[model samples]
Every structure is written in structure tokens, then in C-alpha cells.
Target: MDKIISNKEKSYLAVTLSGDNDKEVIKQMASALEEEGYVKDTFADAIVKRESIYPTGLPVGEINVAIPHTDPEHVNNAAVCLGILDKPVTFNVMGMEGETTEVSLLFMLSIKHKEDQMGMLQKLISLCQDQNTLKEILAKDQDKINEVMTALVEK
Candidate 1:
């Protein structure tokens, strides 16, 4: 994991059953942010490119999690956006998960320091054990997903 941003500080949480590839999913999240004026069109394309060759999917030993991201030069502001998938989205893994896994969440990170998020990333990985919390967020509709995301900030 490069570095994971605070789930609380993360503003956008989109519950999407996106396309198969990591780059495709990155495009989905990045396009939404771009439409929201958080990033440029070329920036989104750059993000997809960064994620294409250098995979950001983290293997949990059993399954995988997609951490699609790019250089801060692609983003207009410092923020984090998430895309949760109930149906698995196939993305490449960095570890020995062999091939790939059905990713449940897309923790699309937009950060300043590409690697300084080590501590926060560690914290996020630790929090992954909270299955109930994860389930609640994953099971939400679009409106409820926003609420759940906003609640993280309140806490």
C-alpha cells in the first residue's frame, strides 16, 4: 500500500459495480471527480495510465482491494474518494494472489505526498477487520452511502 487517506477526511463515496479492469474503475471514479470539478479531463486519463502499468491493488492474502491513484498533478485538490462494489471488480494484485480477485472497494486516493500516507494507510488496513462497518457502507444506496461517508467525518 502506498498510503491510505483518512476515511473520515475522504469526502466522496460512490457505490458502484464498475467495469473489470483497474484502469476502467479509475476512469469511473476520476470521471465523476472531473465532472465535480475536482480534476481535469487529462488528469483523469493520467490517473488511468498510472494505474494501468503500476498496479495499486493490494492483496489481503485471500482477496484484493483496489487502491487506484495517481500523482497529485492529476488532482485539483487534496481529497479522497471511494467506490464500493458489491459485485467483484477484477483488478490486478501486487502480491502473490497469483492473478486477480473480485475487489469489494475502490479507495481512490488523491494525495499530495504519494507515499507519506503510510501511517494512515496502515490505519486503514487495520480498520478493514471491522466487517460490520464495511458491510453497512457497502450495502447502502447512493443517498445512504453519502450519509455513511459524511458520518465518518463527523466521528
Candidate 2:
């Protein structure tokens, strides 16, 4: 599975973030990936810029989530970060032009290839849409979240 979840001291896969705004949240996620060498230093800025244009927020079932990512050029290693916010932050809705939603969970992706990016996106969106899965994820700690996501990634 290529260790899709990181186990470094500053865990990247599943962690609680307390960024007060969308930009801050995205930056925090990017910083964690960068710290682990999963992404280039440019990743943080790139993702922030990308999110401004193509918002990835979705209001699925009960909870709202966001999937923020950037071009493959900014990624050094492919990995997904799951950030559970202490409080929800407002994010622009995907394809909804000017609409927005409050997102409490975020999946920040660092994909090294465009093709893989699409596949991962599809899988993540599908997983996020399941209310039960989302609830389970939110209820667990970092280690358990890693188990859940690792299982999901392997599938």
C-alpha cells in the first residue's frame, strides 16, 4: 500500500486542525505534508491558489467536507491528509459559483500524477458521501483514523 498514511512524529494522515479560516486550514495541511517531505515547499501556495479558483467543498449527507489539491508538479510523494477541524470553516462549494458550505473535515491530497489524482478523487468522494463512514472517521483518534483510511485506500 506504499504507506499511504504517514507515521512520522508530526502525523499527516489524521490530525486535528484548528485553523480559523479556509486558507489557514489549507496552509496547515500543506505544511504537514511538506514537513514530511511528501510535497514540495511550493505545495502550500499552489493549493491555496487552486482552492481560490476551484473550491472542493461538498455538503454530503449530514457532514460537510473539503478536498483541496493542486497540480502534480507540487507533489514530491503521493499521500492523503485527513484533517478534522475543531470548528467548521467556510469553503466555497465545488461547481456552485459563489455558493459556500461550512466544512469540518478536509482531505488534502498530494498526488504525483494527474491520472492518479482523478482516481483518488473519485474514491474519496464516494467514501465521504457515506454518512456512516464519515461518522466513524470523526469518532476515532489519529491511529484509528489511519486504520480506516488505510482500509479505504487499499480498496
Candidate 3:
């Protein structure tokens, strides 16, 4: 798996902005993931199941996002897919605040090894703290996304 925290996207992750429903988003993410050989169809169920129990939304000021995912079993390879909605999508928040809000960012996480997963969420947490990176992403194009990935990895 390419280092998501480092912003090294090995290739294009084919994410989509479709319907407003959670299932629809999951399906879109899973299809892109499977197409990239990161996961099997089972990953859709894994993501949904994970979200059904605990929501994945993380809030940081105006940047509300979701990182819906499951364990390593569903992944054939390891990668992260980013899906940006035309309009902010709503979902239940993951933390203690537990509020529901529109999500502008979506990160589908998959890890082949559990050990590699340890610092990832924490890395994301810190990255989210960097307002400049978040601003750049919110306004970046796909090519820019790729560039951001490169910059992230070099750091």
C-alpha cells in the first residue's frame, strides 16, 4: 500500500460523487477500491457493517469528514480512496460529540497489515490540524490531489 499519510498515491483512486445515501457512497468507494485491486466486493459489506455499529465522521472546525472502513480481512491490497462530494454529505459523527453533519471529505481506509495501521489515524489527526493542507485539498483538482500526495510523501 502506498503511504496515505505521506500523500503518496500510487495511482488514481476512482472515487465518485453519486447519490446522497450512505449505502450509495459506500458502494461507490468499494467499486473504486476493488477496481484498483485494493479490496474485494466483501469490503462494501465490511464498510457498511463497521459504520452500522460506529459512525466514521471526524470533525475539525469547518472540515467534517468520514473515514468509513473495516479490518484487514477484506483488503486484497492496501490503499486509501478519497471521495469529494459536490455538496457536503451528512453522516453521524464518530467521537464523543456524536453530532451529525455534512461531510465534505471521505477517506476509505484499507490496510493489509494491522501493524501498519497503528500510526495512520494519528497521522491523519495531525494533518487535519494543519489548516493549509486542508485548504489546499478543498480547492485542489485531481492533478493537484496527486501533487499534494507527492508533497505529503516527501515530508
Clash count, candidate 2: 0
Clashing pairs in model 2, backbone N/Cα/C closer than 3 A: none
Worst 10 residues of 3 by lDDT: 1-10
TM-score for each of the candidates: 0.71, 0.88, 0.81
- Candidate with the greatest TM-score versus the true structure: 2
Q: Write the residue-wise lDDT of candidate 2 on 60-92 in tens digits.
A: 867799999999999987777888887889999
Question: Which digits, one per residue and each the tens of the lDDT, describe model 1 over residues 1-155?
Answer: 11122233454545364565666667777776676566667777887777667666765633346777677777775555667654667776655444666777766666555565664456456545556656665665455555544543331
> Cα deviation in Å at residue 95, candidate 1?
4.0
lDDT of 3: 0.68
> Model-by-model lDDT, in order?
0.60, 0.81, 0.68
What TM-score does prediction 1 earn?
0.71
The residue-by-residue lDDT of candidate 3 on 1-155, one tens digit each, is 12222232563352447557766787787877786677887998889888878888877768777878789999997777777665677788886555787777677777777876656666666666766666667664556667644443232
Model with the higher lDDT, candidate 1 or 2: 2
Q: Superposing all C-alpha atoms, what RMSD in Å does each candidate have to the true structure?
A: 5.8, 4.2, 4.5
